[model samples]
Target: MFICSLFFIYIGEQLDVEKNLKKTAVLVGNAVFYVPSIIKMTTIGGIYLLAILLPSFLAGYRDYTIGTDVLVYGNIWFHNAILSNNFWNYLEWANNSSIGVLYATFNYVVSRFTSNVHIFYFWYSFVETALVLMTLRKNRIDIVLGMSTYYFLFFNLTLNILRQSLAMIVIVWGFNYVTEKKLWKYLLIILIASGFHSTAMIAIIIYPLYWIANNREKLLNVFVLSVCILFIVFSEKLTVLALNIGMLNERYSDYLMNSNIRGGFFAHLLFCLPILILYLTAKNNIGGSRDSQRYNGFRLIVAFTTVLSGFNLKYVYLGRVTQYFDFLFLLAVPYIGNRYYVKIGRYRDTLVTKLLIYIYLITYWIIIYGVQNSGETVPYILNFN
Candidate 1:
């Protein structure tokens, strides 16, 4: 956390957007001259540019902190023997119980290295962050606004949420496949992703709804209402099904009926209000009439996640599931912000033009400083120190 702060300060001082953007162009599909054609949110491309670069380089360096998942997963390495005869025993333990096969297998395979835990953490953070950054940019979410939310809100999560973080990465790409109308590709990807975390199957559940959102805008209002009702009614059954399938941790069984898991209360508030405002705005402005299927896809994802947030308010584990889907907010916020920006004019440098940046900063503070689980990052330190 400390080191990250300094890095941010250094970034604030030394980072030059215009120069670095051109420098990083080849890395970002080499769209240098095609800026006007490619851009959707702000013309600046600052946020998308940062998302593309920041996590791949910096995420692996963070030290563990209080309330962080790192302390738990990192220690798993020290507990497991490298190539021990008992390795299969550990596999049996995970497989027979609730741990998804891929995560368990991933841990065992990576643990072959002496420093597998740190390596695991690093590679996981790198791949997860990179996938999301590329997805946002590919989907044409305003790079600047989307990336701002990525840093403030979602970045720390890649440091934690060890398993679902991977699943989130898969679904972000799955959205691109969804937009492209590649049916088999979408199904195959989401199924494989579920192996990392069972909650990812929620992607499958919401996939049909995504079609409804994009193809039938007139049905959108009804579909949106149905999603809300369907989720509230079936979320528990879905939770039970995931438990039975071992997609979720069996340890969370108590939370199924437990009322104490008032998780994501504030987070839900943060996600829902903006989503409602945006949904209404989309409905009123473009509504079903808008021609951009990408925008429709964006709206569907946000709405799906927003309804999931309501379920999250009921239970923390449910909220965790909601979170994997809710990451669409990173893309959706910028879309909405860009829509607003378009009303006034295209993405601009004016403070009023970039208000989403400010909102993201405030959200960043709330998550990092306010939430117990969220404030999990510590200064960067090699695992051995």
Candidate 2:
């Protein structure tokens, strides 16, 4: 925890280096000794490297006890693949078990050279972190803020739902394809991602979501409402369809099959209320902004999330599918705090709004990591022994 604290501090300091360069120069006048580290920390190359590597180091060297899945599933899967008599047997097992082909193939290939699961974890962490940062970079987003948000929210996802995490990041990176209307390219990427986690195929909706967003603004409202209504009405049919298509997988189906149809409608709506409010407030003002297209695209994702949350009333396990879209809040929160209009929201992009946003994010972080321990990533233990 102390190490993670320092890491965040370092990242936080570097975030405003470009903006505060003059102030930094005045404070450190004639301090030649501090120049190199300061310059390195502020540069794109430097932040990119540090952000990816440091988290990879922390997540990779962690004990299996940190995430429940590490002990219960990831370790077992890794050892089983590596210890198999032959590659064919391993492939047979993976096929029978419904493990994603790409995920299984990754394990098999890595096991060929080294059976050390930590090494496997390190590389996995590196690739996943790199892809996420790369997406932020490609979109010209504030990488430091994006990475910080990811650390607080989705980083633990890499540890718990390894395959789905990989697939999710790939889909995140492919957002550009959707915005560009590159149907084939986007579908190709989705296909590859689906090879990692079948549920990733559900992200194909982003294309149409963006299309709907481009239509009359009121159309988005109507379409989203309709989706929620349709999903609720057909919730059971949809679940059965998902199971039939092998989207839910056997392990999940075994438990969810017997689970009650507890309406989580209010719970999800409450959880998403903040972002939904932010989106509607920012909507009227963003038409003239440079990032308007990006914002609108993301707005559709928000609407989709709303539809999914609404459907959560009938089928609780449908919540799992929402994981792919929930990350929009990490980017949206900062965007609203910084760019949301004063006329509409009355926040004026002031420090007060920023402060409130951070407080909200931090509160969620504490609730997830400290209180609920959703991913079982608490009392952070290193694999030092």
Candidate 3:
């Protein structure tokens, strides 16, 4: 799996360069452009081969977090009689209240067929990975760096948020529909995903915002400032309403009120400063007016949401909102790395960029592993193992 992942990453990077080269060649009316286009076509074939092999690799990897969550869901379903009442209740509160129904359902279907829940996790991981890869492919991103970034966000740490991960798939599906101007498909997917997790319903509002805000690059900074202030002043009230309206677990009420996961007040400011610097530096350097405008707009949104995540712990949910923007950066980073660092200078200049990437990877890994290894819960399957 790791080897295949590396191969896909290489193909994606090569194709990215080739695609750009083709666009440049078209502008210059040069026959030399054919070389890059041909290389891109070859890379496409390599990508397809890697995609074919990904499933086998993912299937062999253990999803430790999903295994633990499944066990927690099973125990809640079986141990608590309230959750076993009916299918609706099973869907709504089984993981929190009743373990029997959840256990029975899984045992009758998922567990009964598989050797253990880890296998189920593996399958889910594979499907999620495939869905993300398809989404990126559709977006015309085929590079290894792009795939790595997508995998890190969607399959790595996100495995802990099973419902949210599924919601993300629906959200991306909705994004495609919106981009294609397919209203019905977009709404349908959003609604279906909302049924699985109520938080997804928020996308109904966010989608419209996404549409309206698509071209509004300057407004992103304003929106970020506004959301920060609104959350800061009304956080308690918002938490109360969220709990009352059943958007948040009641147990989290106190945590929301008293906990201080706010990181640092200036943390977001610090992060945004670099992006702001990049934007200023690249504003004139970028080619293609339309593409530059789109990138600027997208970067603003990403910067806004990332800053908001640090302003308040409750805005942790807004992490999903920032993820869409983070994806843009993930793609841009490698291109930028290649352009300014790798191409203009020695490959050694790319070392800093690579170190920054590894730093992010390691930091996220620590956060995820810390949460998973806290030992508050254990998967039933692993217990047997």
Candidate 4:
């Protein structure tokens, strides 16, 4: 699994070749102008297509044991629950599950074509990874590094929490709209994303953070600090209120009530410290640029996720809430590594910082996926029989 992820990372970086080709064309005249065009073919020409395909194929071909939900939930829905002799009859079953109407409808439609779960897996993985890649490309961030983060942190996650994975990706794509101040469009995207997973509804709070980041930066900082204290003090009352108000379902309400795993509070807090320091120091580095604004907006998002991390101290399910925003770290860490600097005896370089960031992310992957076996995705299983 790790080797395949590394291979995908290598191929994903090939996206940089497009920019290099464009530069080469200008320097060498029309001789190589069409070279980039040939690569741009949507079918399979560019490295971009190959990058998306390899991971999707690997994910799609995985056997049931490869992920916790494959045998338990996803394949069940794709093969039986959403399939019926008459397709329309399964809507009642679909509507009964926690799944959103759109995703259930998607499964029902796919089941009509065939009951083979592998094909369903392939198409779903394809769309999910494609959205991720397209979002990185659109943001003009480092696609290679963004993909590296995704491969480490999120790709295996998509294998288990299938529905929420789609929701999380949609919300990640919608982060740009939040920065752009597109209220209705962003809200609509959130609404659509919520159809995939109810947890995505929490993302609606992000735009307000964007507003406060731009208008009241100091207050945002104070709020982040206060969040831990307040949540710790009133965690029970807040959980009850949220459940009574229908913000959380019965399942999560029960889970929250039973959750006593409070040991990771400090670990979560420690995780936010370096990131908070990076945001505070690096703001002035890219002063007054659009990237600065976007970075500032995402920093507050990190802050918001920190507050959710605080909630996880008592109500551990808020951990899922934090996962929706994890992709931003890919953007934030790389941007900080490239842009943040320090003066050391009149010598300064970001190369060391970038290398450190890579080491940290890879170590995180090893610990969470390799050691902890998150999502039960450590042993990559192939379905060949």
Candidate 5:
């Protein structure tokens, strides 16, 4: 994970350099600096060594976990799905006959040649990490920072849900496609992802709505009201429907019902209040432009989604539907910290500012990891070894 973070930072810096030769040199330099000289090491030890070296080697690297999902899922795909030939059974269950046959053929070919699942895990992680890097490139955020964010680490490392993780990668890639107005390409990606996990179908729904959400305020109210009503009137039905979908296992269902929505609510509240306060204090600061308006609209929609997580666990359990919005809070809080509070001329580059940001990010991670690990709500079956 940490080596991957360094790789992203190196790529980001090299993105600005001119000439293909210089770019190639930069890539080689990064690999030489980062990749180990040792020919062999245990996976866990290697990961630990990289983690320790990452921050020292790349001062600007932020821990991102987008690739973690692929790593976990790839482990599962290699061990349970391919090794045991269960992937065909899953495909058969979905009535994807052609896909089952293709997967069977691939599995047979691989098993005839190699028995090491770790190799498969590594290859899958590499490819998935590349895909995630590409998606992050489209967003123009710091790839290292984006990789380190809670969105990637918590779900990928802790939850260790493989199919859903792949689905998320697909969703991220789909977002890039949709944003570029490549509808057919976006749909194709979504379909491919859905083969891995049905939850990805949600992306199909979210994309069109994201496009239709032109009237931000109105859309906010409608989505909030609709979710609330859906919870109140159809929570049971929704629960049953989720069960029918067979995406979630029994353990996850119990977690949704038993866990305290209050803490989640409070977290959302804390996140939303800051945004609200910032908006009130700096509404005029935005200078009233179309882009500003669009940003504001995005803020509101995300804030509303965060708040809605508190309204119903059913929604949260519905494949972390609310989490898609939670990313907004993650991005917003940092921006707000830097924009409103840090820029008051009292704390620019000061120890206090840095400490506050560090503490906030650390605390955020602790809270997120704590809540996730609070119970056996979800399975952690990754081949961490």
Candidate 6:
């Protein structure tokens, strides 16, 4: 934990707000860094690779952390799953979970081969790490920023919300085809992901929303603002109605109806500040084709998260929904900062603005990594020991 604390500080200092500040690499998820590292594997390059892999290894090795999700949801579920030898039993389990058949089948197949949950966990962690790392490289998200955000927010999720994490990975992977406009391939991928986590189906709407955003930016902003306002006024009522819907999955229903835990105001504020800052600063007349697509993609996600953040203010439990979209901001904020700010604008390059961003990111790191321990891999455990 102490080492992680120092690492966070070092990375914070290393985030050069001024470098590559004018490129789409920030918006499109291309990470800005020392170019020399990319040309050849130097010391910085080695650190980048280590930064990506260390957390994944820790997650894979974790046994039972004192967190609500990992202790019960992951370890116990994997144990219970293996007990059912009959195919029908696995189906029954999947039915109760309201998860996809392939998801259940995957677990059942793994159970047949090994009873140790650690083995299954490592497999999930490794695959998840691969998926996320591939997405970072494929999309060109800065390695440090992407990995930092993943560790800070999404890593704990991979521990507990096993199905949805896999679903997220699938949806992220599907974007490759989505950007290509290969409708059939994208739909198939989404369908496969939904099998693991039904909530993944919501991503199906993203493409259409992208079309709306790219073509109708003004209307889309208005719509998002309206939705946010509406959610604020009638969130409780809407939450009730959503829960009452007969077709809602049992697990989702439980989370909404039964779970009482809600992330506080500070957490919501912290979660949203990065995007809001970048968005307010975003300017046009810059970036390339890659930048345009990535910008639109993140802008669309930011709009949804902005609305959901409002919903979270009222229906606190609705906060969970933000995870689906918030991950993109890791790229969006950096993109917006580099693309729009630091152009010697009246306010952007001023000492105060530069200092403020560094201070904010630094403070955020302290809270998220040092204090909150949200990733729940602190004092990282090695399973073999």
Give all TM-scores, in the order shown: 0.70, 0.79, 0.60, 0.80, 0.59, 0.71
What is the C-alpha lDDT profile of model 4 across 1-385, one tens digit per residue?
4355546545545534554443323234545444454444332234466667778888888988886667756887787644476655666665555556667777877877876788788888889878887787687766666677677667877887778789888988877888889999998988998888766776766776677667756866577546544544455566578778866555656543432222245545544555666666542445566867777677877776676666665666555556656656756666677666644566566665556566766766676667667566777778944
* Highest lDDT against the true fold, candidate: 2
Query: Which scores higher on lDDT, 2 or 4?
Result: 2
Candidate 5, overall lDDT? 0.45
Candidate 1 per-residue lDDT, tens place, 163-245, comes to 76687778777766776678889888888787776657667655666577656466675766586557755777776787798
Q: Tens-digit lDDT track for model 6 on 1-385? A: 3246327434433543333333222222675543432333333344444554555556666767623556645665667678777888777877675656766776677788888776676677667766765675576544444455555556655665677778877787677676677878988988888888766665665566555555657877677656544553464465457668755554564564322222444665676766565555556435687668767767766766665665565566555555556555545554554455443546444233334445566566567545766555444556654
- Provide the lowest-lDDT 10-residue window in model 6: 19-28
What TM-score, to 2 decimals, does candidate 1 have?
Answer: 0.70
- Candidate 1: regions farther than 4 A off: 1-68, 71-74, 77-81, 85-93, 215-228, 241-249, 254-263, 282-291, 311-316, 338-353, 371-384
Native RMSD of candidate 2 (Å): 4.7
lDDT of 3 by residue, 1-385 (tens): 4446757657554555656456323233544543556656666666755664574345334434332344445333333333244545554554353222323444334443554554555555555566666665565543455455554433443444444555566576455665555778878876766544444544544444444445456677467546644644465577679878876667545433321221223333333445444444432323675444445444554555555556435453343344443434544443433332222343345445445554554454344334433222223112234
Per-residue accuracy of model 5 over 278-310 as CA lDDT, tens digit each:
544542322345435345544555545645645
* RMSD after Cα superposition, model 6: 7.8
Best by TM-score: 4
Q: Write the per-residue lDDT of candidate 2 for residues 148-179, one digit (tens) a residue.
A: 66776677656777888899888888878887
Which sections of candidate 5 miss by over 4 Å?
Answer: 1-90, 93-113, 150-159, 180-185, 208-213, 216-294, 313-319, 327-342, 345-359, 370-385
User: lDDT of all the models against the reference?
Assistant: 0.58, 0.67, 0.48, 0.66, 0.45, 0.59
Worst 10 residues of 2 by lDDT: 255-264
Candidate 2 lDDT score at position 168: 84
* Better candidate by lDDT, 5 or 6: 6
Question: Per-residue lDDT for 120 in model 6?
Answer: 72
TM-score of 3: 0.60
Candidate 4: C-alpha lDDT = 0.66
